[model samples]
Target: MELDRSGRVLAALSVAPALAMAGWLMAGLPLLLLGRFAPLPMLLLGVPAAALLCWAGTRQAGKVVEATVWQVAGVVAVAAASAVFNGVMHSEQLIVRRDPATYAQYAAWIAGHGGLPISVQPEAFGGADPWLLFEGVGFYGVDGGVAPQFMPGAPMMFALGHWLGVPFAVPAVLGGLAVLTVAGVVARLAGARWAVLAALTFAVSMPILYTSRTTFSEIPSLILLFGGLALAHDALGRPGWGRGLLAGLVFGLAVLVRVDGLRDVLPVLAFAGLLIAMRRSSRSTGSARPYGALGLPLAAGLVAGAGLGMLAAYLLARPYLSYLSSSVRPLLFICGGVLLLTLAGTAAAPMLSRIRLPRWAPAVGAGLVVLLMAALYVRPWLQTVTRDPVTPEDRRTFAMIESIQRANGMPADGRLLYFENSLHWVIWYVGLPVVVLATIAAAVLVRRLLRDGTPFDWLLPLAVIGWTTVTTLLRPEITPDHPWAARRLVPIVIPGLILLAAYALSRLRTRRWWVTAAAVLVVLVPPAVTSIGTAFTPVERGEAAAVEAMCAELPPDASVLVVERVTGDRFTQLVRGMCDRPAAEVKRAGAETAPEAEVRRLIERVRAAGRVPVVLAAAPGQVAPYGPATHVIALVTRQDERSLVDAPNGTWGLGIDVWMAVAR
Candidate 1:
């Protein structure tokens, strides 16, 4: 088979992101196994490995696929342009926001030591280290030491960038690749015209812009998720175990990047099951099957690969699990069960396919099962939100939100559903009209998929959109501040909606050029403008400087105590990681004032241990009681104005004052 210029460009676009993501995942595995994740070695080893995989996947297609040199150049040019744009929009300094700061610390540790740290310094406050409880800082205090409480995926990617002297590079690059991946998928599913439109739409969506530029895990997760979907789609189309194994491998990596990815990928699992079933049923005809000789192996490989990948992730995250007071045994059982069930289903496919059923039987059965499962998962969450008192987790999140509402002078005790529009939050960032059109497109696609048989092409997208949208809407946790909550939708909603919109536009059948152009502009322009404008806006300035200055003034042997006042202390990780200081938060939960006696005791203990003690407070008054003997230095941090919209004003990086008492 031969390909046109656009087709060839689309192919290249697909190939590059897949290669990049595969390289990233492959590079981390060896380092992880060796207990040392060095960036230079990963890059050196990963590049060749990725190239070989790409070459092997494409070598057998037996097609003279060629695009104009200009076309290939355009793909590279666009990817580069998007990367630069994202990088410019990213955080200006080392992030000090709670989660980002935590991930940054993980990245820093990985980059510096080439492995997970044994323990972070103990909290300076009265309780056992806050990190142990996954409080105050983004760490879990374990057995007198602290470890990061996040999955290793994003941090591993960040560590790679840290080695290259730019910690933000990984996400920025992945963000650009995500855009290309969207375009590539659209091109394959629709056409090149629509692919361009899809790429442009994704590139400028606010959710994409925001998540890609931050240390948020969503960007890397989306890259792997989308890349895996694209590859899996290709494997399904062509009968080959290699492609299937590769797709499964990529999907597994996505799970490693974020545990929630297991939920995100359920549709892929179902789709693989369907494919195996179809292949089994067709085998009786003695006809050519699309999956060729290795059809059964290919299907089995995807399931096995994903299972192993998730198991690997669970193993790597044992420290985090210990901190959460959870065990790996349950996760192991789950993984083993999934693998067993999948293998059993595949083995039984031949027997099952022989049994006659109505055409709609599978769809109806699957829908009912999913509905039942969702109900089971959501029942307790709904009760907590409505009938039951707020749980501790919800209370903490509510406290944070209430603090923000107070700072912004918004009403307290608003309706429970005040932020319940989580389902529709995309409309705020991408604009309402675009959302309406995307909805229409999605509806149209669903109708077609149901009316016609569920082709493999449509099955994955439909499942992803349906499952993700449902879960996102029913998300039981207190809706985090607006745009940030939208981060959860980035790996699914933005891309899914963009693809649907592109499909809608492609089906327009109108020959009028002006009409097509107008339609495209209406769907694409507003969100693009909003996102691009936000990208150019600077945020979080002076934060790095403040942390640096504070660190510089502290004695080398000083231990730091962060007193959580109005802001509720999330800066311990920043001090611990950025300032290279042992830091802890003074527990002031629901307290009217600082625990002066406890604070003094901790200070005395630090002194007795031959370390100077410093107290850092978000509000100056928190340290006021220390009085004449106390020396205070003011530190200022500027926050991203955008973050305050959903979060407390003080949640973002803020200016703080550090105080220390002199022994007289």
Candidate 2:
């Protein structure tokens, strides 16, 4: 009985990874499939898929727990870290007013008026609107036009939020949770020590923590990308028909999450094919059974995933077909490449089996995969190569990068609820190719791990380093060594940290445990302090208070214009609710200023609109000439840096300080 129980446990352990992969894929696959057929198919497919996943996951939990404590701990830690990061840093107000809200309202405006489409033609060439979140409409800058450049993922998430709640912060918080799920899942795959490191890296290394609380879909898409990879790995390692089916489901689901995620899925399928090839080659004599067993299930899975994804795309596109020309073409290119690669990989398998192959064969096979990845990287790479004029978006992004590039740049203004524009710079500078490279490297590492050396894997670290390197290269802001800004490197930070921590624990050297403990303390402190500070203080309060103070100082009848930083969502709520403010409030104000000298003209217009108009500037130094001011009030001030706040305002406030200026 004892021996039988042990054997059963071992058998279950061997199949666990595949089972997990299949379960997740099964859960997400139907939604993707349903999407392809019709939106209503979601009810037909999702209920079944979700039920299977839950059942499979629950059944496996006991066996997984029995296999290793590290797995449990890693999963819990990654999830906990993500939760802690967002829980501490995220807030309701921050979520609703973050950058995306500006776009959300614009989308809503379009939806309200016959679902107008927005165009996204940048004056500068090589500008990125790569994802096409709003290809249904165009994002024509801040005009709230019909055509916005945003992708469907973000708008869909926002739309869901609008249907469900007020504040819209709930979606942002949920976005953070999605990020947490990715971190947790990745950490678990990396192992316990690495998992903790991954969590730390995610928490502090990259902008994942920051995005957790924002309405942005990038991080959520990234999480889905990782999920696809993990599930594929699980399926490949298990070698079961059901698992392969699940992998297909996951591959389809990934495409549904974000278009970029599809890039990561390619290498996973290639790796799976490699496994299938290996299994085929290992069989003695050409046997039909082996070929059928390996190829049929995999082919079925491929069809399911691809078919489902295509179905979803068509269904989603049905409502708005005209705007999809540019968007749909890229997917076609991807599909064509996938088909060509699959054929090539299949054709080359027999040749790869030969011991004394043609001299150019290895180079050719290797070169093909490399070229495919190179092609994918090219567009994003070129975008980074070109630089644009530094506007408000540019400066804000630069400051974010500088925070990471410079050690002391973490602004003391507030800890939590601050948006990092630098992350975009990092991603662009870094290139989207790293996602592909990391997935490939991780797959290779997993293969090596199963073959058995020390059971240590390099996938996690490769992912982190590759992402960080790409991010650092593309970003105009941030040097390589910025400490607080180090969050940009979160992809690899946790994995790298885990290696160090693991090494410390395993080392027989004197006081090694102390070193590990100290490392944990160091990693835990920054986030802990950030969380504490964020909980007690509001990140938006400085700007919010400034806006409130500026409003209070103005007369009820006066026309006040905020001639700074153009327009964005941060000021949206205030402007929209202006009519609802108290009796002492001024008539509704507006935000004005061009990215260039036209801002001065706009300020002049405000001065002309009323007698002794109160023009409050926040980032005054960014603008020039301070233009003739009767009474200028500086609601916020930064260091002696060139910005809108530094323009020679007659009165200024420090912290909560108030100052008054007499009309000239």
Candidate 3:
């Protein structure tokens, strides 16, 4: 029984995710155990683990599971192409965004210092002060010490690259892995050809490209999420304790990366439970008892595996949980509730199997459940928008939209309208036609899954695509930037939609190869061209250059005060991360005094520490009191107002004046 092309592709696809997941998990263990995550250790442990998993999968796969050389080559080719494309588009310099800069610094510290710093005091001006808070660096000042606000998953990966002396290695590698995982899953569910197409579509997406270049959480999160889904699919097909446990572990690790992943993977738990419940339904009475014996261990393995995964995530992320105060309770409830439901469902599977219903009954129930969930998720956003005086965050976003509209010679009154149309921002990158088609394809897939009791391999993809699409469209709370806000959709929704579209195309009954090829090109070329164009477009370098100049003019041991009236604390982190300066921010808080008094106080404090004091201000008035006594080291003047759509909290290309107070 030599495997056909499709069988071979499916087999390879199943094995790939488990191998990747095992590799990442094995690689990360040392970080947990030794408090340092390095590439050499990761590869040393991970490669062997992956190879062993591959060997095990192959041995158990029997004669019907053999990927051809061409099939393997094709997957690798797509992954390599994705890696190259993302590497080329990688940011030449870090942008004004706080998160990416912070994550980079976190990685740098881990790479250089071997663990999370006891205090980011080294990066603080005049050393660590119990009372002083570091506003922009994204570190939590708690109990007289500072800790990184983000989870360690992304930083752990970045530490590997830093170890290798490659700045962009983490994103490049993870981005390629994400593409490969999507392709592999698509191959397993749809076919080998669609897998290739899905990988290409994801590689060319503008949002994907933009994210791949930066140190964002989405890429790493996607790697875990997709990898988990692939493994879970394999487990569903194989129905073994080992496979189930591995899937659970991968899913759990995803939560460690992004807490929100707990929401993304709920369906997997339900799917696993369903599999357990139905395992004995198809067996004969003679074999029913034997099958029932097998089902208990399978169910227990899955539950135990997932429980362990969640427990590991909680232990790893306990420190960062403080920063996510609002989310802690809900996340705990969701995890707890899902585990309980899985146990209950597994326990009651025999009873559930005895109950029969109309074919449409399950579909109807699922639809109602999805609607209720969507409504629950969207309620807060709806309430927010309906408020009389818009929230401060929304107000700022609206103002930015109005400014962009005014610049483009469009009506500035469409701020609310823009917010409403934020859901359609996907159209801006992939085109309206593709979005519409994908929506239709999504609908078709959902209908098929509900109507036909498809296997887990088929059901999981549709569930992911459908769930992410609905959630993204209903709750696009991010600022309505053309391609950037669309980033919220990139990790799952966009790629999922692309796969759905590819699957839809594959279903077409056309036998002509050219016809299929042309259809795929037509669907993908527009976005690819748009993404390529954006990739080549130079990043705004003026702001970065001005920062560099400021760093150069100031003394090596300068304690800089960023006095930002509009862009508060944004440049503080950038300066600290990029220029290796100990920086702080002076905002509307603190004592109200004359600018001269404030400048004198700041200068005296720095002078007491034997470091020079510098002020970087967004407005001239903020620095006016310093007078001619202060040297104007670097000034950046922009003709237009900086649009805050992409980075709502930060200002990019904004006019800035840098001043250095003359040392006494």
Candidate 4:
């Protein structure tokens, strides 16, 4: 009985990340709908229900194949050790400056209070005045209330961490689960022997390590995406539709975690269509209808999950959706077109299947992939990607790029995107072995996909990975800094390439054992070496302690008003979320100091409204005129340094100070 249950356990573990996340959504969504979102019920009821569901599905798989018991154990062991290490090294990003802090603040709010549209409590300032800007850097004022700047999926997951009183734990644990799932996918596709190597290579990469130790959306999204691949792979073997539905649900729900997830899963939709068409063709020929039932359920589940994500975005994150309207609108249109074309192809499957293609088609297809890669490789010499500083965000990015350029002793061309060097970015993190192996693997797989038309499982996984990876490399559209810009690659590009590299090495092992060993060393060494500089040294150290001390300085009923520019940008959400006090930053003209008369008027309004008016500034003198200023927070930390010309090498020092005073 013990031996028999091990396989089931491994199979269940393969889908554990997806099952756990889906369960949380299962519990949280209804609560969110009912305006009673809470973490306790999500943890107690949601997770267990998901485990039961996963167990039931595993049992129904009927002799599911998994890695050897020891291989599975090894994967689990690595994941466990990684979780401990990551938790210890996790960064404290409680104050808003970037995506990490934004997600943290959003989750903090959800954990404390279960509702949408976080209220700005305008009455605390005795109604909004021109000087009192309710909108913080990341929290947008929408519909007379404030909403976070990104999709709620990540914050929703992080909320569970918030409830547990260890917000960093979820990312660490999910990251481990991501490793397990990635290994499971490699085991099933490449071979069971490569599972441990895949796990090690994935965990040691800097992108994975960096995102795992912070509250980033990429880790959770990676877990869900790969778990969906594992589930979908299982569905191909099983006779039932349970695994298929779960696979599509998880894949589609990735959008809930990160809005880009919708773009990542487009191939799933296309793959489903292909399956439907193939099944229809098989029916006409009186052949086995392999994925007949599974295909429709997969499509339905995907639509349901993606639809739920969009609905949540529209209702809960309208400001964010509006901001992304340019890209989001086009993606939705593409999805619609893909769905319609798929339906049409399904109807005409028999006719399409009867038509024969040239035998050179598969080879040509493979050649095309190689050619495309070579083109991207040579792009840097031929063209330079740049953009006009049209939007405010674009101008800010220009300034940041200019600063990095000056610091790095490079020419001051802030407009240079350097996106043409994107392939080099992949090589930087994963090494040239991975790039070479992955390219060969992609080409060979494409040839097989076009000719033999079997191994139906690879269709969707490869399509999703290939499509997302190529597109991202073409247009990173980010700060062009190491680790910061690497977030774009971490979600799909890094892991996907690693999976392909494993597949290539596994295939090569039969011909040359030493070749496989040497390749493995080459593939894993660069990423491991790159991670050494800052892996043990945690970023943003002492930030939580400083924020706690600062929070202690303000009264519970205080209306905190920030007077300094940098302090206001960083602490607006921190004060509102962590301190549990109403807070706003006084608005000013570009680079102008806060006007004293206007600030005085704002303080009087707060006092008249029966709330203690607390003024805060980066320096004591800035707040001393209002009342007796008391130094509250003094922090010295290190942040990840910007690196545009090469791989990131070190950290930069960061210092923060806050002084507070209560108006009489």
Candidate order by decreasing lDDT: 4, 1, 3, 2
lDDT of 3 by residue, 515-552 (tens): 87787777778677666546654343355456566667
Runs with alpha carbons beyond 4 Å of true place in candidate 3 = 1-75, 93-95, 122-132, 280-336, 359-423, 431-452, 529-533, 538-556, 565-568, 575-581, 587-594, 610-662
Q: Count the backbone clashes (under 3 Å) in each candidate.
A: 8, 51, 0, 0
Clashes in model 3: which pairs? none
* Candidate 3 similarity to native, TM-score: 0.79
Q: lDDT of candidate 1?
A: 0.62
Instruction: Give TM-scores for every candidate, taking all chains together and pairing residue i with residue i.
Output: 0.82, 0.52, 0.79, 0.96
Best by TM-score: 4
Pairs that collide in candidate 1 are 120-146, 124-584, 131-140, 131-141, 132-141, 239-291, 404-648, 637-655
Better of 1 and 2 by TM-score: 1
Candidate achieving higher TM-score, 3 or 4: 4
**639: Cα error in model 2, Å:** 15
* Candidate 3 lDDT trough over 10 residues, lowest sum: 638-647
Per-residue lDDT tens digits for candidate 1, residues 180-263, read 777767766655655655677677777787777767888777777776666766766565667777766666666667766776
